[model samples]
Target: MSASRPVRRVDRQALQGLAHPLRVQLYDALVSEGAATASELGRRLGESSGSTSYHLRQLERHGFVETDPARGTGRERWWRATEEDLRTRGADFEDDPSAAEAYRILDTEWARSRRGRHESWRASRREWPMPWREAAGESTSHLRLDVEETAELMAEVVALMSSWAERTDGRDGDPRYRSVEVQANVFPNGRPPGVSTD
Candidate 1:
């Protein structure tokens, strides 16, 4: 979780730009794997260079990615995601049916990508060192809470994660440090069989 950058609230136009599956994958690759050339992304994603270059330009147009001037030669360009955290509210696009649809698509695809990454990690978990294998996993807890309480809990969790990220921001190039993914999902589950809403 890189919280050094501010979270971007996706607007209708940006939503449309990001709704495409390939664009979402491209953006996720840059965020998760760091900067890369379009050709590199194409090879990793199994897409043609022409296809990746086109989508990368579209992502740039929407402010989702930008060239990494520090890397790449004059003939090649490296791109990185502009923001690690992006959020969208359906309420913002309630009146615009198409934008609403785009929001749904973006949300679904992003979740799918997250799940895929987690699954991939699980498949390769044994290949990592013992310390990492011990640390890398998931946890779930169910609690009874009203809407406001749930929101409060989620906010606190996010704040803590951001603080950790900020504290460790300068540790780049450290041999002991590896890119770690942090995901938190907080939402109300349906009432338990014997539980009452009241």
Candidate 2:
């Protein structure tokens, strides 16, 4: 199972060959960080330039991203996502086993990355003062909301988070205030006893 839940849905054709870890990471980076070059991606991701380029090609094959003319890089290629959201219909993923598996793998990969970051953040949390560390909370419950309501809530949450990200100027030139990574997961805290919704 994936470590984290998938946010965007992708189609069968788009899911093809996207199971690979590198390709999934590249796509997530592009989706989360906007556009970047092979070298920049390599530097940020700690992967080799050659490997970044290779996975980039795989991403292009899957129609995940396309080169931009505005930020020309001569030898280096810059990529941006084609769609705002990765949307998939019932037949695209549910009807195709391979595509479903690919989606699962991608979800797992993303979860792994998210877990790592969460761990790192938790570890570093103590370094900050109590005032800063005490500003967070956790929850455990079963959310009962209709699909449309849930989607609306998610959209509102995303907008609230993006409002922070969109800010150009923040607390000094400090790194944390300059940029922040937000991970929002709304789900049950633990398994309920002997209850299978399935």
- Maximum-lDDT candidate: 1
TM-scores of the models, in the order given: 0.89, 0.62
Tens digit of per-residue lDDT, candidate 2, span 53-147: 88898888877778966676678678876544454443457666777777778778888877876787788987977866776544445677766
Give the best candidate by TM-score: 1
Q: Global lDDT for candidate 1? A: 0.86
What are the per-residue Cα lDDT tens digits for candidate 1 across 1-198?
444757788888888998898999999998777789999999998999999999999999999999987788888999988845687777899899999888778778889989999999999999998999998778989997888999899889987877777777755447777778898999767776698889
Which pairs in model 2 have colliding backbones?
none
Segments in model 1 whose C-alpha atoms lie over 4 Å from true places = 1-4, 170-175, 191-198
Worst 10 residues of 2 by lDDT: 1-10
